[model samples]
Target: MALTQQQRVELSSLVGDRRVDAVVAGRARMVLWRDEGRSAEEVAALAGVSRPTVNTWVRRYHDHGVPGLADRPRPGKPAEVPGSVRARILALTRMAPPAVTGLTHWSSRELANYLARHEETRVSHNFIADLWRQHGLAPHRSGTFKLSRDPAFADKVVDIVGLYLNPPDGAVVLCVDEKTQVQALDRTQPLLPIDFDRTEKRTHDYVRHGTTNLFAALNTATGTVTARCFPKRRGAEFLTFMKTIAAAYPGRELHVVVDNLSTHTTDEVKTWLADNPRIVFHFTPTGSSWLNMVEIWFGIITRQAIRRGTFTSVTRLTRAINDYVTAWNTDAKPFVWTATPSEILTKVRWVHTEVRKLLTNNDK
Candidate 1:
C-alpha cells in the first residue's frame, strides 16, 4: 500500500505511544510493516494475528486512512425500556409503597410486578436491579437523621466547634458525658474460640449480672480520659466524678462539655459549679450528644472491651473497663476534629431544606 508522510508518522506514533490501544497499535504496526516490504504472513507472525486480520486492516487503511485502525460499533438489539419508563420506575422507587401493598420499601421484583400490573410496563427484576445500580439508587436502604430543635443550635454549634478547633490557651477542654446502664452480661455457655475457618461465637442468651454507669472526661489536648464507674448515674455521682477530674488536673482552668441531661444540670451540680471558680460547663444542644468527644471513646471501649466480655459480676466488668482505660492512657492520641461550624451548619441547613421539600411534596 502507498502512504502519505503524515499517515506514516501517525502510524509510527501509534505503534510507539504507550497510551494507544494495544490492538490499534498492532494494526498500525502491521500496516507500517506491509509498507516496509514485509509479506502478509510475516506481518501476521510479527503482530501475533491471523493473515486475514492483517489483510483486512491493510485493506481498511488503504481505503480510509489511520481512523480505520480503531474499533467499529458492533450491531446489537435496541433497549427494551425507553427513557420515560426508566424515569417513572426511578420516581416510583423513591416513593413509599402504597398502603394496599403493605410494603415499607420497594424491592426489585415488587417494583417490576407493580409496573407491569399498574403502569403497563413490562420489565424483569434483573433489569430493574441493573437500572438501580447504574443510577446509584437503593430503595431498600434507609438512613436516620435528627434535626436539632434547640433554639440556640447555631450558637451551641459555634461554641463547641470553636473549642474543638481552637481551644483557649492555659485551659483544658474536656468533653464529659455518661455512658449509662452498661450491662454486665454473662453468656449462658462458654464462648466458642475462633479457628482457622470459624469465627468466635457466643450464646445468644446471657444472664444480666448487673449494670454500671461510666462517667468519662476526655481531655481534648492530650486524649487522656479521667473515667470512673458508678452504681447509679445521679447528680451526686456526676459531682463526684467532676471532683475527681478536678483533682486529676489541679490548678488548671477546665471547660467541660456535657449534654443537657437533667442529672447534669441538677441544683447540686449548679452549686458545685458555683463553688469551683476554675471550672465551667458547656452544654451541648438538645438531642446533640454526638458533639461530645467522649462518646467516640465510649464507642471504642464498647467495641474493644465490653461488648463481648464475659462479665459474671459488675466488679469484673468495672475491672475490665479500668484495665482498658489504663492501657489506652499509656499511649493515648487525641481525636482530631476537622469540620468547621460553618461547614456543619451548611450541611444541616441543606438537610432541613430537603426535609421541608419532602414534607411539602407529601402534603400535595
Candidate 2:
C-alpha cells in the first residue's frame, strides 16, 4: 500500500529520533525503504534485519500507520536506565556547564561525573558520548564573520558590483590590486621532484632572497590579467601601472575596481586620474576585499605557483608569476557575481545592527 505524505513524514521523523527504541526505529526505517520501492532483500540488508522481520513491519505499517511499529509488551524485566535519566543527560548536554562546574563545555567524563553526583544516576562516559552523537550535538567548535564599517560601503559595493554585472559597451573594467612583499626564498637543500608514486619534498629551512610587489589588473570581461612587478607598492608605481593599462586598452574608458588602500588614493594617483579623466577608480568597501575579483586570481596563482615553488631571487619569482598569468589567461573564465545588491545590503544591515548592540552592551 502507498504511504500518505503525512505517514511518510512521520515515519522519517521516527527514524531520525534518537529517543525512539532501537526496534521501533529499525521498523520505521524498513517501512520507509519499502515506500521508496526497495525490495524486501534490499530493505533487510539496509536495516540489518531478516527478510521475515522486514515483511512483518511492511505488513504492519500497511495495515496501521507508524503506531503499528510499536513493540508489543515484551516478556522481560523493565529497562535498567529510566527514561527520566536519559532525558536529563540530553538536556544537560544541550546547555553550558553550570558556572560552579568551572568548565565552558561538558566533556563525556565530566558530564557523566556531574550527572552521577547531581542526579545519583550511574551512567558511563561512553553512554554520554553515544547520546551526544545520536542527538547531533557538538559544543567544541566555532566560526567567524566580519562586518564592513566603511561609511560609504553601500555606494562603493554598488559601483564595483555594477561594473561586474553590466559593463559599458566600449569600456575595459579592470579589478586592480597589489600583492605586496612577496618573498623569494631558496631552500637550503634542493627539493625532491615528484615521481610516479612519491610526492615532491622541500626542506623546511630557506634563505631569504628579498621580496617583490605585484601590481595586477584583471579584465573583468575577458578574464585576462596585465601585471607588473615593482620594488615598492607606491602611488607612483600605481600611476605607472594605470598608464600601462590605459595604453593596453587604448582610447576605451577604464573602470578599475580597487580596495581602500592608502596608496591607491594618494595625491600622485589622484593627479594622474585628473589628467586621465577616462580612467575611474571604484574602491570596494573597507574590510571587504572579497568584492575584488582580482583577489581570487591572486589566490589561484599563489596556490599553483608561488606557495611551493623555490625562487632563488626576486627576479625568478617575478618571472614565475608572469608565466603563470600567461598560462591562466589562456583558459581563465570570468568570476561571476550572484548576490544581488539588495541581498548584500540586507545582510550588511543585519550585521550593522548586531555590531551596534555589541558596542552598546560594552559601554554599559
Candidate 3:
C-alpha cells in the first residue's frame, strides 16, 4: 500500500499511542509495515496475525482509509420479548401482588402466570427472572426502617454526631447501653461437631437457665469496654454502672451517650448525676439507639460468644461474656463514625417525604 505523508503520520501516531484500541493499532502497524515495503507474511508474523488479515486491512485502508480499519457493526439476534413487555414486568415487580392472588410478593413463575392469564403477555418464568435481574428488581426481599419522632431529633443528632467526630479536649466520650435479658441457654443434646461437608448440629430446643443484663461503656477514643453484669435493669443498676464508668476515668470530664430508657432518666439517677457534676448525659433520639457505639460491640459479643455457647448456668454465661470482653479489649480498635449530621438529616427528610407520599396514595 502507498500512503500520503499525512496518512502515514496518522497511522504512525495510532500505532505508537497506547490509548488507541489494540486491534486498530495492530491494523495501523500492518499498513505502516506494508508502506515500508515489508511483505504481507512478514508483517503478519510481526503483528501476530494471519497473512490474510494483513492483506484484508491493507485493502481496507486503500478503500476507506483509517476508518475502514475499525470493526463493523454486528447485527445480533433481535429481542424475544418486546420493550413494552419488559417495562410492564418491571412496573409490576415494584408492586405487591394482588390480594386475590394471596401473595405478599411476586415470584417469577407466579408473575409470569398472572401476566399470561390477565395481560395476555405470555413469557416463560426464566424470561421474567432475567428481566428482573436486568433491571435490578427483587420483589421477594424487603428491609425495615423507622423514622424518629422526637421533636428535638435534629438537635440531638447534631449533638451526638459532634461528640463522635470531634470530642472535647480533656473529656472522655463513652457510649453507654444495657443489653437486657441475655439468656443462658443450654442445648438439649450434645452438639455434633462439624466435619467435611457437614455443619455443626444442635437441638432446636434449649434449656434456659436464667437471664442477666449487661451494662457496657465503650470509650470512643480507645474502643475499650468497661462492662458488668447485673441481675436486673433498673435505676439502681444503671446508677452503679455509671459510678463504675466514672471511677474508671477519674479526674476527666465524662460525656455519656445513652438511649431514652426510663431507667437511665430515673429520679435516683438524676439525683446521682446532680452530685457528680463532671459526668454529663446525652440522650439519643427515641427509637435511635443504634447511635450508641456500644450496641455494635454488644452485637459482636452476642454473635461470637453467646449465640452458640452452651451455658448451663447464668454464672457460666456471665463468665463467657467477661472472657470475651477481656479478649476484645486486648486488641481494641475504635469504630470510626463518618456520617455527618447533615447527611443523616437529608436521609431522614427523604424518608419522611416518601412516607407522606405513600400515605397520601393509600388514602386515594
lDDT of 1 by residue, 12-95 (tens): 888765345546777888898899998999877666569999999999988888889887766897457776677667666655
Structure candidate 2, residue pairs in collision: none
TM-score to native of every candidate shown? 0.60, 0.56, 0.60
Candidates 1 and 2, the one with greater lDDT: 1
lDDT of 2 by residue, 185-266 (tens): 8876432111111222233557889999999999988889999999998888888888888999877899999888888899
Score residue 38 of candidate 3 by CA lDDT.
95
lDDT, candidate 1, equals 0.80
* lDDT of each residue in 1-364, candidate 3, tens digit only: 4799999999988865534554687788789889999998988766667999999999999999899999776699745787667766765665556667776567677888889888788997767877777867666442212467889999999999999999999899999999989999997643211111122223365788999999999999999999999999998999998988888888899999999989999999999889989999999998677678888788778757987689999999999999998999999999898888999888779767755665565468
Error of 1 at 328 (Å): 0.3
Q: How many pairs in model 1 have backbone atoms within 3 A of each other, for residues 3 or more apart or on separate chains, i.e. clashes?
A: 0
* Candidate order by decreasing TM-score: 1, 3, 2
Candidate 3 — number of clashing residue pairs? 0
| Per-model root-mean-square deviation over C-alphas | 17.0, 15.8, 17.6
Candidate 3 residues lying further than 4 Å off, grouped into runs, are 1-145, 189-204
TM-score of candidate 1 versus the correct structure, residues matched by position: 0.60
